[model samples]
Target chain A: MVTIPFIWIMGDLLWNGWDQLSFSFVFSAPQNAGREGGIGPILISTLLIVGVCMGTAVPMGLGTALFLSEYTRHDHVLGRLIRGSLDVLAGVPSIVFGLFGNALFCQILGLGFSILSGGLTLACMVLPILIRTVEESFHAISQEQRLSAAALGLSKTTTIRRILLPAALPGLLVGIILGLGRAVAETAALIFTSGYVARMPESLMDSGRSLAVHIYDLAMNVAGGNPHAYATALVLVGLVFIINVSSSWIASRWTSCNRLSA
Target chain B: MPFSTFFFFTLRVFLVGPLLWAWAWEYPSARAEGERLIITGSSTMAPLVSEIGKRFETLHPKVRVDVQTGGSSRGIADTVNGLADIGMASRALKSQEQHLNGSVIAHDGITIILHTSNPVQELTDDQIRSIYTGSSTNWSHVGGPDSGITVVNKAEGRSTLELFLDYFHLSNRDIHAHVVIGDNEQGIKTVAGNPNAIGYVSIGTAQYDAAHGIGIRLLALQHIPATLETVREGRFPLSRPLTLVTKSPPAGLVKTFIDFAQSPQVHDLILQQYFVPLQG
Candidate 1:
């Protein structure tokens, strides 16, 4: 049943977008509101947005995970409070995050509609998921390992830096990858923050449209933009597929290397 | 040990990469060298204006025109707050928005649509009102197939819904909608897929889709055939002006861009987009 939807979507995208996919289509500037030309600027904007999202999210999510798993007891009041909020945040619909981002970042912070604001908004949205994933990975590490480190008289920070982090690397990568998928595929949150400018952004302060937003605008708003919309969707699906495969490959390779070294 | 090193290396790259890219790619005071005009609002008018903006950019290398779309109200709000230099609104400025200056660049008509296979060729305003109000539930009552009618409606806050409500003299509360759609294409697709479905959308979009062999037909409203020609000739009853709004009378680069948009140079672009240029 899960594969059915995947096959159906892939089939539809391929059937409609195969002919429209070409070198120039991926590397040229869009014309006539994305009816013609390539998605070069949109691709760059998507990358930049993801970069900002990951850069901000990784440190914060890792710190929160460490705090939850190492610095505090599971039943500690502060830890419980943090977990409750994160659970609630994870349940909050993305549109509410979009509206909140618009009010706080675009209006209050005076960032207006820019990639930086969009990235920050995305970082906020993905933090709960990232933190939860990393925390679970930390917990999956056996208590015997921690007791052994303590017996060896290693400091807490050193144990975390040299032992815990390397062991939890795969889960961290998975968390990053999952958060990345959500950030890249996002349309609603970005439409309010990053904006819909199709220009090649020269700076983070400049407004640039993401691929999802471009696909949305082309399909829903612009007349006669169906073919290009299909092509863009195909490219987006391809991108997610690549990210998933590459991350899994990295995880497997890292685990094998760890086994060989041990 | 190698794994730890590699992990730290990846961490450093993630932490420092964006900052280094931002520093290296930062333009040396590019804003001072070039003028940028930010225009926001009205998803319907965004594409046409974006095309005009691109042409304007080619003409003047030092100028940048950035167009953004949310909705007509956002356009007005942005213009009022000075967040955008210009706002694109697809409807006439209401009395509350009289302080803002508006310039009409083109015209778009709203027309009733149905599946092409349906035998109903036309409908009176009273009949449409009855169908929407649920007083007439079956297509047989409207001189069509003997099946239940599917009433498709635009979501709230869409200018199409507002215009529809105004023309029909009905409130959104009064209509019984089976399906609510966001954009013209979705509405068209719904009606096209259902032989008993009836909906309304931009005449330009409906005509384009119909010409492309989408199984949808534009129905004549009040005996006037819904065609681009009628919209161009100013005889279409339910047409609205695609206007650009500014907080005050436009001047300088803003005025120049607005003038360029209204000039005959962009008529081809306008016609290409299936919208009726203000000029004949």
Candidate 2:
């Protein structure tokens, strides 16, 4: 029953977006708000934002997950507090994150409307999920694995670096991929933070538009850009699909390779 | 299908759900409304129409009044197609739209708005033009702080943008805006957030928000204030007629609605919506 609606939507995207997704449409900056030209800047901004968000999120998420899982007792007050906070943060709506990002980065930090502000906002949004999932992955790694490394006379840090991390690698990748998905799909938080200007960002401080915002602009506010909006959606869906398939494939292969070597 | 494929399919479906509904749902007509007067058009004039509609409905209890907003273009199109009894337009009718009769109901204008914390109280006409055209880039360059000036512009399909472009003698492509926002509130919010930002929006909207402590100030153009009194007194230079457009000269319920909209009874209502009434 659900598949029927799902197939119908895919057909619609193909119908609306097929002819409009030309080479120049994917490669050139928009002219007339996607009425005449293309979505080049939007694509670049999306990549830059996702890159920055992931770059910040991965290190912070991994470090926090490692500390909470390894250093603290299960019920440590601070750990509980951190976990509780992460849960609450994950529940916070994206629009609230947009407002917070506007206040902190755009106004207080004086970053203004730029890709940097939006990237930071998405990083904060993805952090909660990344930390939770990564922590669970660490927990799922058998305690016997850690003990085995300890019995081999390896120091705690060395054991963690060489053995524990390697065994938990697939799980950590899964967490990161999930965060990547959220970052790529995020729209509301970026709306206020990233100024919706359809031009190539000259610097990190320059405001840029993402595909999601561009699509919203073209589709909603007026009539002339409807065709372009549908085409942009098709491109966005295709990009997300490639990211998901490749990342999960890499994780699965790495996990199997580790098992065989062990 | 695999779980991943199904999950991905579901996500795409969810995203397109609204589009599907829009495509499937039939456009509502006056016939569908039943004993109601359907008004459609610019979002700017929507609130005023509803206010007047409520008053008219009370005066004639049997007739229900419904107002919907898409934009001015939708207004003209709906009226031409007989989908609406009256179309609310925030700008004067273009020459191509001569077939429809547009009655001037009130007046409003696009005016420059700045954050209350901004030091520059006003700007010269040339400076305002330069700022929008990318000639003036920094606030300090324009008698303000050292921060770069953020220019917030209206989106396409808005009458405010149309009036702004016409008044300044600038093309849409000439606007070097840092942000493009839809509707008056978004423009006000953008200006309120940035200390060095300037935007053009309806003067009435700016005045109303300023009174409500929204932390934005409307800058005088050519040294004439953009207050309600000034707008009424014909001192505001960037003003546009707020018109009630009908496909042809209105009659029956449509004519009554138009007459009521332009009458003295809605003067307070117009003033409350931040518009200058066309008459005493």
Candidate 3:
């Protein structure tokens, strides 16, 4: 409780100043020292990286889940192996993922410090959680739905698409939200792979920094640290809260609609 | 078409297209051979090191210099951990950093900057200390216009902030819980743009600004200007050395790079990069 208010006070110290938290600081290009400017490009770059990671992870996660639960029998060797592998993948630390991404995506693929490299690296990090949640949602469906779909002579793919996927949409959305939260908050992996430039991402090839990295840079590298650190922290917390609440609300609404249709 | 086909198509459009696009464009080959120098540390020194790296690589086409910025502490840590060939810092090393061989590459003076619109010309060391430590919250208490003294400081783990505190003899003084910003540039921006603001940054960086959009007025300490001459003469209170540390002294390609860095060829380059070159 004490730390929470202290955190808020820290945030206000950063944003309260005209010079530190000006509109230009957020919107325009940064100038040299003893000059006024903005960080609009970095903000946009952060969002672009986050968007790519979430977009890729959601579908891949759902597909893995579907393969594990609906399509494969419990006794199948491949399904068991994949399930076990996912459990291990989720347990691996983020720094390890960063190392892997640096080697595999950045070095082998020629994607030097690009947003695409960072996002793709993040997708690999988020994939395990996505797969697990989506699989659980598929498992939670009632046996009766499967029986009824089979009775109707619905094709395997059709039953999965129209019935299982729609039924599991809410849980799948939650998985996506969770993945997004992790991706947005992540700093270590993106720091090495994404690379920090002050400009907005021009292409998948452009180097960029996420908001968390920007906050870290501001608090640690930019001089006179505390006020800017706190202010950037405030912005970071606000962003995370917005993403969390909005995703939860959207997921709940979709789930309610699915229930009504069922 | 079946809903499955539609869903697959949706997945393909959203996930596969972008993922493949990112993968193909970003990842380059990971082959490591010949001349490769990995450097990590202070962001303040990153641009400087990068410039030197660029020059060195031009001379030796086979060499590749990869520079990454973490904080100064991380730079020292990277050098200790054998993760980097060089660790760059804007401040002196701690006792822990003593295990590595440290060489002074350059020197910089930390200038106390304020907006030019403010009427105050110079601030006494005590007044500066009182304001930063929060003993004086308002600018008027220190003979300036009546406004809250918005003290901007570096975060924990920064060598620049640590050096400043030491310079002010405020190492033990509890910093007013509010003042924080990270780099010298941002501090200059915050102070130069705000009438009531006071902050610190490297004089070298201040000189790099040609437009002077922020109009930073440097404060003199105890009748001495925070100039490179005063800093070299040991008269300036806020001057500090820039050190490059390594776990082991340079050998092979790394030695060639270090020798090049210390050469007169890179001396002019250092001045162009806004840092004063070290004299033998």
- Tens-place lDDT per residue, model 3, B129-225, is 8988889998789888888877888778777788888888886357884557767766776776677888878877665441344477877888897
Cα deviation in Å at residue B248, candidate 2?
A: 44
When only chain A is evaluated, what TM-score does every model earn? 0.98, 0.95, 0.87
Model 3, residue A54: displacement in angstroms? 5.8
Model 3, range A1-262, lDDT digits (tens) per residue? 8899877765565555434665666667533211235557666666668768878777678778888897799779999999898899998988788878877887788776668788889999999999998888898999899899999999888888788887787677678778888888888888878865544344676677677776666554543333444544555666777877866765565656555655
DockQ-superior candidate, 1 or 2:
1
Computed on alpha carbons, the lDDT of every model, listed in order, comes to 0.89, 0.79, 0.73
Q: Each model's DockQ?
A: 0.58, 0.02, 0.14
Ranking by lDDT: 1, 2, 3
- B10-100 per-residue lDDT for model 1 (tens digits): 6667546865676568656456778889999888888889899989999998998888888888888999999999999988998888989
> Can you tell me the CAPRI class of model 1?
medium
Q: Give me the runs in candidate 2 sitting further than 4 Å from their true place.
A: B1-280
lDDT of 2 by residue, B64-157 (tens): 6656555788788878877678888899999999988999999987789999999898899889999999999998888888889899998888
Looking at model 2 chain A, report the run of 10 residues with the lowest lDDT sum: A217-226
Question: What range of 10 consecutive residues in model 3 chain A has the weakest lDDT sum?
Answer: A29-38
What lDDT score goes with residue B204 in model 2? 78
Q: Which of the numbered candidates is closest to the native, going by highest lDDT?
A: 1
Model 3 - which docking category?
A: incorrect
